[model samples]
Target chain A: MATIGIILFTLVVTLAVMLGKCQKKPLSNACASFAFNTEMNNLQGYLLPQECEGYVAGYVNSGQYHSDFAVAIEAARTYLNTIEADQDGKDLIVLDIDETALSNMPYYVDHHYGVETFNGETWNAWVNNASAPALDAMLSLYTDFRAQNWSFAFITGRSKSQYNKTAQNLYDTGYTGWKTLVLRLPDEENLTADEYKSKHRKRLEEEGYRIKSCLGDQWSDCSGESAGKRTFKLPNPMYYIY
Target chain B: MATIGIILFTLVVTLAVMLGKCQKKPLSNACASFAFNTEMNNLQGYLLPQECEGYVAGYVNSGQYHSDFAVAIEAARTYLNTIEADQDGKDLIVLDIDETALSNMPYYVDHHYGVETFNGETWNAWVNNASAPALDAMLSLYTDFRAQNWSFAFITGRSKSQYNKTAQNLYDTGYTGWKTLVLRLPDEENLTADEYKSKHRKRLEEEGYRIKSCLGDQWSDCSGESAGKRTFKLPNPMYYIY
Candidate 1:
């Protein structure tokens, strides 16, 4: 009787779980709300005006604001392919790391308790905290570009020593799929972030990569907007370099 | 009051489900009883003899089988670095599709159901099905290798017409995150799968890729065997070529 009872219990439990999962309102959809800690921190128009040009409004109507980034990514892909490829047949899209590919808004809002800026030490601390999520538009853009054989390169102001940490952090933060993720190094030290970035972007082009497009919250990501390519901007009013 | 009641009911159900998940075994622990479906229709050493010896096993696991395939991926700084360069500056480890990186065992086993031989049309049906999981050891191997800077190149047996289907299937079935994926093309029709694969592999070598390792479940994957590179080998006893 005990053995029979055990079997019956298992059957009931399995069925219940499966049935629950199939239901439209599955139990505990509560934590579907479990977005990144930095998801909600982008108010105050801290993002720059040039980056702001990309916002077509109603970006987050589904409450996720998927389109703002989706349109941007699709627009970038359409525009990016025309750039000539070097011998290697790669189309490069330069991207920034912070609120660009990932959302640091929640950390700033909650952990720093409304602080609007960053330093290396604090930024490193947050990444090590490993609590961010890939921003929607960026994730979509990365996947779409990859599907089309275009490459997305992350050229960030994050210091060089944190390369592994940053990479691992990105993976942990659900930015796992991108392959060409580059970080800033101190040989990048004396150079302003923009200067180092411009040099590297040119190097990437010279090395046979057709850098078709550039995306970022910072001017440095676009080589300080000096490249001849067409640029699509996103609004990052929450934070920008003067 | 109704909303409060709903919340309370949800909390009770949540506790029950949490208990269930906690009691449930880890995904890793669920392997043994997991029945597989190999897509290939052959069960009686289904691959051709040379296909087994010279093609699948040879190039698929040629050279060193240590974690290099997974290790080399860690060196990828960006998609460009992953595709073009490496840390020690060697871009190696060209991966094979089918049983090398992904387990086609389940799909293969199904096509051979109640029989002990290989059949082509049934294999085609399975290819149409294109459902297989990345085996656990290989997944762990890949994740670890990607951490070690061993860049990966995926070459598969499905023809070019099957590229979109194959890639989507891989993405759906979890054989994803590869930087470079190549498909088998049946269009030319003049060359055998073996000759076709060898030429492509040679082309890569000619392009300056210092391939440190090759992996696949068929001899054609290691078409380098005649060249004496003797690529790595992994066991596939459930399906063999007579």
Candidate 2:
């Protein structure tokens, strides 16, 4: 019988790869979930203890982490109301550094990801395991957009010899207001760090400044031709890079 | 018949709550991945050109773009043998801007992962759909480490009001060399951007230079405290946050 139908198709593909590595969803399975904020905050079950410790119990037991933090706080309040309606000289917000700020998947499930076979001694033992925690209030609304003067940059993917261990793990995590860490020069040649953030935002829009909002966790940090000036998003289900 | 078996058990729990939106990948499958040096230069099995249509599917299909020139040539010869074993005087290699160099993930898969029902008309229709090509010999070795003198800094988490759309996305991608661009500080008290990159690597070890190496894609950019030095990881795997 064709070797018993190839041994029942190798036991149904090894039970579908052990059910996809035992998938997951038991933080008391409120039944996997549908969430888009569970019909805009109607939330019938759990997921709030600080977003169940910053999500991942199959997205808070299938709840989609409160509809993805209400769509990343409604895309950071529509990018702070389009940089407070930028009049042109003070209105900025561009952010995109590793999954849009912070969260490393417990260092890729404590070094299980391995990515592309890299090995700086098990990646310095997963950067000495500092442990991933923050995401709530995301550094106090980026320090209330630096008390509204509005200026923040972290644009990251990390290159140029990881500037002293990504600045000592963000100085041990406090994410102060922000200065301007852009990284990835490794030796440069006609720019590539997203075209040096689009020629440093066209030299701060010819030295006047209007950017008016751009955030990340990807989506081109504002979307192309070297993005920004009105885009905000944050809620990277986990790993990234495309 | 027991009310038709209780209406077939409420139609199998309403089809298991509408197929539970089938997850195991989808929040736009985190935007359908395909990177990690195009699957470690294997080009994820063919089909590229037309200026890399929908890109992120490289590893083999044809093979040409050598931006990360095979792990930046073994991480720039182990970053010039760790700055010629320390006594090499000037050793600067710090960077972190927009996903560790360049790559925004087609603006986060054109706004599907962010979700809150994505607005701004789907993020300006994915920024008028921009092109996403890069990795050119690791950006020509970051312009040969700024003509070999060796110095670069791009530190970012973007907050200082998106510094002109991150300097116009680094001048539309023709990035230039830099020394200072350390963001996060308008009463920065939340700190998480890797503790604001260990206070800008103690101001580059008090501007005495000799950083040796650091690079990223994650592991908090090689966690900090600056010991000896050497971190060159890449391959974001789409996203991470620990």
Candidate 3:
């Protein structure tokens, strides 16, 4: 009976040790996948879904996002300082509109921070309002480059139909002296942002403009053919564009 | 005297309101710049410095880093599934070493989580130990693709002298059936990781290998000519490599 009790005790202790080992093991692929999907879903909208609204809000409110943006802009400035403006006035810097030059934070705040699926009508109305505030760091970059006699071109995903309002907004927000503001035309709406932006950039290069730097919140704005000599990506954990 | 007292009270109230407004103002460019520089300095090593050690430790300990890595690998797998492996066995997937293939966590933990500048002697000793564990997700990826008869080429920045140890470490960690393992040669030591890796990728393409996907923890691993049909970036907030 004593020998039997010793055997049983050993078995019990061994099983307990095995269970503890299992508990301490690293996360399996399934658990990791589930967590990733949850994070991605929260980041699905142009800003953030309701579940992660506080996180995004805190990122902005704590000023970390602004600091990150400043870092990117600083890197761009460092790179741009190395290139002399062409004597032919062909040196150009490309800018994207939304989340790059302008902040749609006011609209997003009103729309559940983009928890709602994008509504074309509401977005168009917001654009027509022409009240978006300048992203201050970008405005400073634009103003500094403009003072240095560098040409600027704004290539945006905003539709050409809203050209009047977009131009009005740019002017009101302290942006001026840009060589061109290229907006998505109705015929080109089917193209991806990358495709459309690349087409416009190729055209700009053909027009004898030497793109010195490209700045955008999305990779689409800074990728593809003729994407400028240097590209700077601003922080936009809100949404992704292919 | 009563009139003077009322005027003074109004001025005091106005002063308090202005002070509140000043306190609520956004971070200035100077403040943002300072914050950015601090963050960059902390990320100067191959891993984080002492100040941000807890942040990185928490990220890894919380398993969020693993989840993010799984997400990237899942994306790559999704893309790869669409491409059929070539009959001639020319289909290839490229992988980066270090944080991508092997977990250096054990070593980093011992070295202040990389607060210390990267020490070649210590790092080489660790490498020669030939005991680095496989990044489990990557091992699963290797096994899965190997079963499908797809080819893999590991292009690592590890020196050629450590080839035997690296090979033994990889094999012991369940990685097998790789078509080639390319390490940095002595003459190629001066080249940037990007330049050296790109050169090898170009050579692979020249050898008629079709690089369907590339995966790495750094942009330098996935950029440059002949990168791949698709590139997936794994999370590595610990450091930045040019």
Best by TM-score: 3
Chain A TM-score values, per prediction: 0.63, 0.30, 0.80
lDDT per model vs. reference: 0.52, 0.49, 0.76
Off by over 4 Å in 1: A1-67, A81-87, A111-120, A173-179, A225-228, B1-242
Candidate 1 lDDT tens digits, A23-79: 434222111111100111111123223322222121222222333344445555555
Global fold similarity of model 1 (TM-score): 0.35
Evaluate model 2 with DockQ and give the value.
0.01
Q: Which candidate model has the greater lDDT, 1 or 3?
A: 3
Candidate order by lDDT, decreasing, is: 3, 1, 2
- Candidate 1 A-chain TM? 0.63
Error of 2 at A99 (Å): 16
In terms of lDDT, which candidate is strongest? 3
Docking level for model 3: incorrect
- The DockQ-based order of candidates, best leading, equals 3, 2, 1
Candidate number of the best DockQ? 3
Question: Clashing residue pairs, candidate 3?
Answer: none
DockQ score, prediction 3? 0.08
When summed lDDT is taken over every stretch of 10 residues in candidate 3 chain B, the lowest stretch is B36-45
Q: Give me the chain B TM-score of candidate 1.
A: 0.56
